[model samples]
Target chain A: MFRPFLLACAMLTVSNLTRPGLQPVSFAVEAGKALAIVGPSGAGKSLLLRAIADLDPNDGDVSIDGIERRSVPAPRWRQMAGLLPAETGWWADTVGAHFTSGKPDEASLGQLGLPGDALDWQVARLSTGERQRLGLLRMLMVQPSVLLLDEPTASLDEQSSAQVEQLLGDRLAAGNTIVFASHDERQVARLAYAVMSIRDGVAEPPEAVP
Target chain B: MSQYIALSYWDVVLAAVFLAINGGLSLWLDLRLEKQLLIASVRMVVQLLLIGIILKWVFAATSPTITAAMAAIMAVFAAREIWARQERRLTGVWGYGVGGGAMVFAGVLVTVLALTTQVQPDPWWSPRYALPLFGMILGNTMTGISLGLDTLNATVHRERVAIEAQLCLGATKWQSMAPFARRALRSGFMPIINAMAATGVVSLPGMMTGQILSGVDPEEAVKYQLLVMFLIGGATGLGVLLAVGGGVWRLSDERHRLRLDRLQQTR
Candidate 1:
């Protein structure tokens, strides 16, 4: 098993980011590990991810590496816990414009199978898979300790999906935590060390992968 | 010097004939706007006549309290107009307060500045000068503010996801919203910019035209019109800037979170 041993600690912790009358969701992801949240459509999977990112208003405590999310300023907290929505929004005219930290790393772009001139491409012309990959790359540039991704590879084909998985594997290998929601069985089997199933806001406590 | 032409009530009735022709055309085209035209004409007549009577009383009274009260009332109505103009308003008091407060603040501040510094009426609050100047500024500022608020809220709603994405990328609320604020300000300022550009060439400004019609010296009227235009421009710019800022403030929370839930669509 590939496990990063740099900093052994609970990198991402969620102590009930759920509403009343619903089962409270509580889980912890150790450094360099990935947790997959799987459930049917409209099962509040995205909502849970948003809650953990503190993107939405919700009850419960979310912390990173022993520091409560509220302790740090929101922008800093968001930087540490970067979120990639299923459909990322591109407001600027060019892809490079969306990247705030100048041009993104060319190596990361190449690893994602994006062309060398992809950053110069107009956002209106990018394919769905390209957008998703760019969104991931954009989030990665921030170098968040925890990556909150919603369907990170849903828009990609088998080859592109594998490339993304490989890139994410490298991130995990570097001791970054990942909490992602996926519907793909293969993705869950391949990436996650733990699996959490949520249905209609009720979440089962995470179980270890066999 | 040409004498100011005083039109009798019968002459005013003759002027209504032009509106009657407009109503006739609306009926012919099945525009279904004849009723609206009639009601609007009647309302305009009543409103203007009432204002005329009130102005006569106010000018005769020559009291600072009366002039200030009339200015306050005009400002309040302008605020109400701004509130009524938004399609999607900030959920509560913020909807009225943000734009309304901007206009009243800008309008009064600019008018007082002009009166005390430039226009310099005997008491500075003289109704003749203060009322007209304040009314013009309030009207222009109202348009600018309402347009700004509308553009800000609409763009924010349309680009909610994009803004959230920026926020997710660790952008502070102001940073995430800077572009939208710029767009809103442009929308707010465009009207005055166009008006200023086209004032003499494309259209005669109402105040200057009224002054000329009342037989004021052309050069003197031009100076007054110039002063009025400059004052309106300053007030509109300040009003729009403040309203847009307040709008951005209302739409977000202290944690730099974008709170789209703060908006309510009125349709």
Candidate 2:
């Protein structure tokens, strides 16, 4: 019954996120800004991302624009503020089944380096890189206000990775806020407007991208 | 129908011969189940004899309290059996309550309907008809709930990410879990469907066979069996529905976040 106004300038916000093995972490990214989270494996980058998305249980306040996470339901919040997990899960047999609108945009599919006929292919036959790319495409199809991407290009080859970065840049320019976790600092240097580094239970306040 | 010949004590021994032969095969094949077979055989006789004595007393007395108590006790056992079979369950007595309550609800509904309608025995609560009918319905319904719950748990565990993705897509909790719930219900109902399909072809069902052996008219026996099967079908549908429903409810928090932690992993 509670319909929110269409969020323009998706201002990503997080406060006091406390989950197991992670300290209470907080940060905010201005609208259209990309915040890169860099940490070693097992450093709780994924946990923090999940917490911010309200996927896992954590004590935190996460909001997009002025709308609080608790104000809307978790399902609605996650839909408006989407999280692409490290290893994406596919439940349906074909690529088309994942999308609610029946078919993913063929042009966007090409942008993510997927063939136009990719939607017709069985999900089981997808290579890890293909799945990863399609997973991002699937998340992007919803056009969430905020995006939590866990290594969006971790499985992509260099050429495909460039395509993804360009696609994400296009989305961010369209006013999406992003928090992505990766060990790739060069990528951070390339795309991030701010950076949050985690090491041994320590999290830095958001710093301007160096 | 002609009068049925009663089985003698020697006839009981003739039944035991099958058990003896099974034990002998275990011994010869080194399957190492001789002690287990021997103990099961002994336990069977003891348990059946004890139950028989109790049932005899129950039938003679015909007290509603005692009848209800017996059914409740059986229901409790069936519920506990369902709880034990589930690898993941709601913590504490909730699992027991969900499983037991579903079976009891379905059983009572079916039983009361049958008694007031098709099966109006002389005393209304005739142990001869009520006990067996209730037992059969409860047993089958309990099996269905157990299967339904197990499938629900496994699906929730296996498809957590996919479900969460759906939630991320603005789907309601029910929308996210509806497909899995349907699958679990199918798992639960498949056995009953198979039995229905195989009835009279694969094998004569138990109630019909027993009634025929007891010198009931074949037509009368078949009719009773058919009615019981229909009642069993309704009871099973309710059982699986409630079990899967309760399971999915406990799976997620009110915030619509998946609370997998609420389910204890028995594996």
Candidate 3:
């Protein structure tokens, strides 16, 4: 009972982090469940994701499992729950320079269609889609219990997108939680158990992903 | 000590002839800096002349209140100068408090500590010692803090997404901002460090030259210059830390979220 409750505590929950353009938005993603967020462009989808990641300033509560985000301290909470924004941040020039802790082997990189020596490649040289996949791989390296992904696979072609979807599916099979925003209806339908759409800043009630 | 030759006002005015030559060259070269040069020279003369009179009274009276009031005014002006130089300034009171407050606090503290401990003058409030030393420390501190504030603000702007992402990865605000803060502090300390390294090697320092002109023995002047340098170094370090620390505080909330909005200027 205690162990299951503890696992439940690892779920991703969002109350709000508001911008002037956004209304208070809230939702939860239970363990192993993927909540797909869909909206028209400028419906505060990215902003909502940022808020959940505690990147933006807004009034409301976000928690993991049963612990309030405020209680866990931001860094630990973020480590446990990760947010991969639509346009991922690349500060280091080399791919290998990005990850401080996670060192994935050559096979994993190959699986992601990256060369073994790709770690040494300059970030500026990487294509947009490649950067997108690498960003996702880096986040997974942190081994977050919950993932907040904003348009995680938007940049990838169909083949790369399929690989990313497979990787995400694997992550879910491990019983981790994910709240992802995507524009592609098919991706949402394939990945999400529940679908929530943003209309006028607030999330419409979630429905079964058809 | 050797008796140094004194210069009359006419002798000082004789030095102004070189400026006219420079101004003439600027005009002939079509650099168009004649007006600026003329205005700067005139302002310098007027300002120094006024300060000379004020210092005369301050030295004679030797009152703590007067000394404190003068130091306060200088700090306030230094704060304004620092605030004006920042590209990304904290809004409202914060702008003044972080940069200016750090400058004044570090400047006054180091000056007072150095004065009382190393260069103790009679009555302690001797404007002769406290005023000049405070000015030197404050000037160095002002530069360090201004550079620090600019670097910090620029870091927030440049690294907002990256920093925010770090925080999302479960970094404490300090952890998230550590690299940026280190960079800011390094840049802030660069000027003082360069000046120290170059002192007497690349160029003679102003205070050493001034003291030699005033007939102080070269060795004695060297000692005073060293003391002032040490004070300025310590004060600049403190000011830079305060600036970087204050910036870190202003740019983040307790929730470890990066407050990029705080970096916005009202202007």
Candidate maximizing lDDT:
1
lDDT of 2 at B211: 86
Candidate 2 structure, TM-score to reference:
0.94
Residue-by-residue lDDT tens digits, candidate 3, B1-267: 367887899998899999999999999999999999999999999999999999999888889999999988889899999988888888778988999888888887898888788888997768999999999999899999999889988887898877876666566899778888988999899999999999999999999999999889999999999998999999999999998899899988877888878876535
- Is candidate 1 or 2 superior in DockQ? 1
lDDT of 1 at B123: 88
RMSD of each: 2.7, 3.0, 2.9
Off by over 4 Å in 3: A1-10, A15-19, B265-267
Per-residue alpha-carbon lDDT of candidate 2 for residues B91-122, written as tens digits (9 for 90 to 100): 77777887788889999999988987889997
> Which scores better on lDDT, 1 or 3?
1
Q: Compute DockQ for each candidate against the true complex.
A: 0.71, 0.61, 0.67
| Residues A1-210, model 1: lDDT tens digits | 223333333489889677533467889999989999999998888888887777766788889888898898989888889899987987899999998845665676889888788999999999999999999988877768899999999999999999999988988878889999999988999999999998988999999988
Locate the minimum summed-lDDT window of 10 residues in model 2 chain B.
Answer: B164-173
